[model samples]
Target: MTAHLPASGTPGADLGAAVRALPKVLLHDHLDGGLRPATVVDLAAQTGHVLPTTDPEALGRWFVESAASGSLERYLETFAHTVGVLQTADALRRVAREAVLDLAADGVVHAEERYAPEQHQRGGLSLQEVVDAVRGGLDEGMAQARSAGDDIRVTQVLCAMRQGDRADEVAALALANRDAGVVAFDLAGPEEGFPPSRHASAFRTLRDASFPVTVHAGEAAGLASIGDAVHRAGALRLGHGVRIADDVHVGPGGEVRLGRLAHWVRDRRLALEVCPSSNVQTGAARSVAEHPVTMLLRLGFEVTVSTDNRLQSGTSPSRELELLVREAGWTHDDLVAVTVAAARHAFLQEDERRALVDRIVRPAVSPGTARPGRHRA
Candidate 1:
């Protein structure tokens, strides 16, 4: 390992410019949750929809303020305006393009934007149509980023809404387009009553076919939900699996004990998609200072930071990293470690992962630092 950061080091000294320039890989972003506020206004107007605020700044503020309500239900309600405006195929494409551009601007070299194709059918678009439109827009944005000398690649992770019954269909769609741009499958939505086990058939189908799968659990739900995501669904990554912190026991003398489930998670080397700001907005953490990501990292969990819902959380990958630096006092090595781990677990092919590490991640970390190795029980 490289030298430990000095206690008096100014971790966030050059956050805005220096940290923003580092390469990143994002695995938990939502397509609809990352729209530009101005684009949302334009799309709503084009679709004859009513918005809480027409001004871009106010609209953005509304989304952030509403999701900060601390109730999972209320936090999710902020997506209504975004999803409503994205009913049209063109609107979906535009948002997809903007997401790519925004991530590239924040130095994301690789990302998998996940969304439910089922939600965009209100305007008569087939599920496949929404998928294609989004893919096309991402391709356009990637080309533009390349033209601007930004080393970036964006892929799709098709998500099946947990509250619905279309998981199998979405899985099939992901398989059909896997060779093109669809890289993975995920189950995303309210995770309390509707567990990943509810979509066992879909997960079974994907598992038998050896498809990459992730599930949103342990965010709005508890450890059982995360267990179902891992055992029943065969998920390789746990989306917002921060609730595993609940299973940890701390002694007065600074000793830590992990429960069986938490031990299994760590021993298996499963990736935990942790989103700090989004976690706070949804009441997972009272504030960034109390976030469990630092603890999980210290405990040797395969923890990777992300901006789950940039719009609703009023954040970006750069902002998320900066927050950890300023609030949690993360060192440069800490930031580099998180970014490298995310790239390692990305849904890309082995060759792609290698190239990403070489071209984007390695330069961000200093020489002689220990790299994350793939280890499992």
Candidate 2:
């Protein structure tokens, strides 16, 4: 079932309002990237760690400015502060719990928050202990949301830093907790030198066990990295697969030429977890208006919008959709379709996915409502 929106002729105010009200799914948010500045300040104070600022707004601005340094290395430095405060079980639980509640407030019905367990071991907690802490927090957060009448489901994606040698260990951890709210395994961190093939053993293990996988590709690197992730790592989704746009050519009369790899990705209906704001901050795209998301959608690619790092990028799922609409002239229908695509590709059981599609995505995109802009072939 697919929901359709009215044409772009609808009033801009109505369009934005409807997009915000639409139930959304987020699959690429990071647990560390969504921390509230006040939470960071409080945690730092409790842990006796010095912060650049105790003021919440200033700290938030510091994170945005630090992440905007135009280099992945600098962008990563911001996480050092965030992870510094997340070294203990209590801290982890607090961050995870608040993250879910925040997503719920943004009208996200489903979300997969990823983080590296290896990063949280500074206080001597084992990998499983870190996982347990986050799980407890998410469970509590979900319960709290339900009691508050906000229906939200959250899952964890255990990420192994590509620069580290713990991919295999992380894969094992994910499999061990498959039934404990751990939904998928991912390879994150610097994507330039640390190719997905470096973690071949981990990918193979996940593949053999049929564990879902998504690799951070096409953001720091280009199509070659995306190719390796798809062919070698068996990635079912491409995290920030923005650079796949490099393979697409806009010909005369608005026709598009898709390279073989791009064609295969689109044809197979593999999800592209595109984060617009983060892409611009990381220089993946020049601007939201210039993002290839519109092109990919027009070309029939399975694209899902996400907030890669809310605090770091200063964005939310609603804000991202709003940016696309205002900057790229997108409509509510487009937002609904993208949200539905995300839910469809979520790392949930088959029956659960179908139920969400029927109950959420379908109703959100019903035809004669404002339809999304059509792409030129």
Candidate 3:
């Protein structure tokens, strides 16, 4: 029989353990939003940055509730605390490294955690310095994981804030470190007024350089935003492209009709970085079971599950898989499919991605083949 999860939303039985053991790939996670609560409290104290809660537990709770407010502004407000404390190079390194450690513990074989370099320059460090610090942290974290016998590999994605004026600068920064630890360039931050079109020139610069780019669209915005990100911005992957669900219509007899924009994304096999918990927290979906990822997967859209923010969403890749298995009714096969999809779309070289798939992902997902790893709960 095919592996299945328990009926309850909490998959503590075989399903939960199986989910945690699964070799996963994460495409969209934020560095600032995934800090350990105690680390945040310590960093805040060191930086003299006051936070909503000094208690680590309380501060962690605050991030989750605040993000669930459904107002992107309120959700983003939590970042001020995390980012405030992460201005220094050491702080950035710790956060990036620890974030990778956490993902490693979650049994993620490959991950790309992104951050806006422009936001981390308050400590008199140049943008390139910020990139170097974060890259260094990722290297250190992966090394530590390797020491612990956890097979994990991670890379950085340099993000440009949407409301900022440094998209091209960030793109260039990505290029500067592409040979190092950085894998891709992305446009992040609020997606409402400042659409991808606002950074068309920067996107063109990255695309012309043959760099991979993923745009934050279809989360706080709709199809117009998604269309622009794909057509105008040359996004190989879409950050929270959940609103692509808007273009899908179901007929009375159950036939599916996809809009042109949806057709373009689907036909191109563009990966949709679907964050279920964060989507509910942001009102993109009413609940995990109601997530459009269910439809996207059913329709054969290239859907890869991820945790947009670990501290804010209170989730990990394993938790994300548990949620889908318990609520979205996903099976082991489904998880394997998405993991492979993410590896294939990853911004790394073709050989590296194939190695991740063939050696780590494929073997681990097989019935008897095993790949050694660890999971955080």
- Residue 100's lDDT within candidate 1 is 95
TM-score leader: 3
Residue 307 accuracy (lDDT) in model 1? 94
State the weakest 10-residue window (summed lDDT) of model 2. 368-377
Query: Whole-model lDDT, candidate 3?
Result: 0.87
Candidate 1, residues 1-377: lDDT per residue as tens digits?
23333233675334566566667799999999999999999999999989998999999999999999988889889888999999988899899999999998887888989999999999999988999999999999999877776767899999999899999999999999988899889998888789888888899889888899999988988899999999999999999999999988899999999999899999998999999999998888888878999999989999999999999999999899888878887877788778888988998888888878886688655533322221112
- lDDT-better candidate, 2 vs 3: 2
TM-scores of all predicted structures: 0.94, 0.94, 0.95
Best by lDDT: 2
Flag regions of model 1 displaced more than 4 Å: 1-8, 367-377
Once superposed on the true structure, which residue ranges of model 2 sit more than 4 Å away at CA? Answer: 1-6, 9-11, 14-16, 364-377
- Give the winner by lDDT: 1 or 2: 2
- Model 3 spans > 4 angstroms off: 1-12, 367-377
In Å, residue 30's CA in model 1 sits off its true spot by 0.5
lDDT by residue for model 3 (1-377), tens: 13344433444466655666678899999999899999999998998998998999998898898899976777888898888999999999899889878887777888998999899888899998998898889999999999988988888898999998999898888888888888888898888889888888888888888999998889989999998899899989999999999999999999999999889999999999999999998888999989999899989899999999999998888888888887877776788889999999988899988998998888878532333754333
What is the lDDT for 81 in model 3?
A: 86
Q: Report how far off residue 114 is in candidate 2 (Å).
A: 0.5
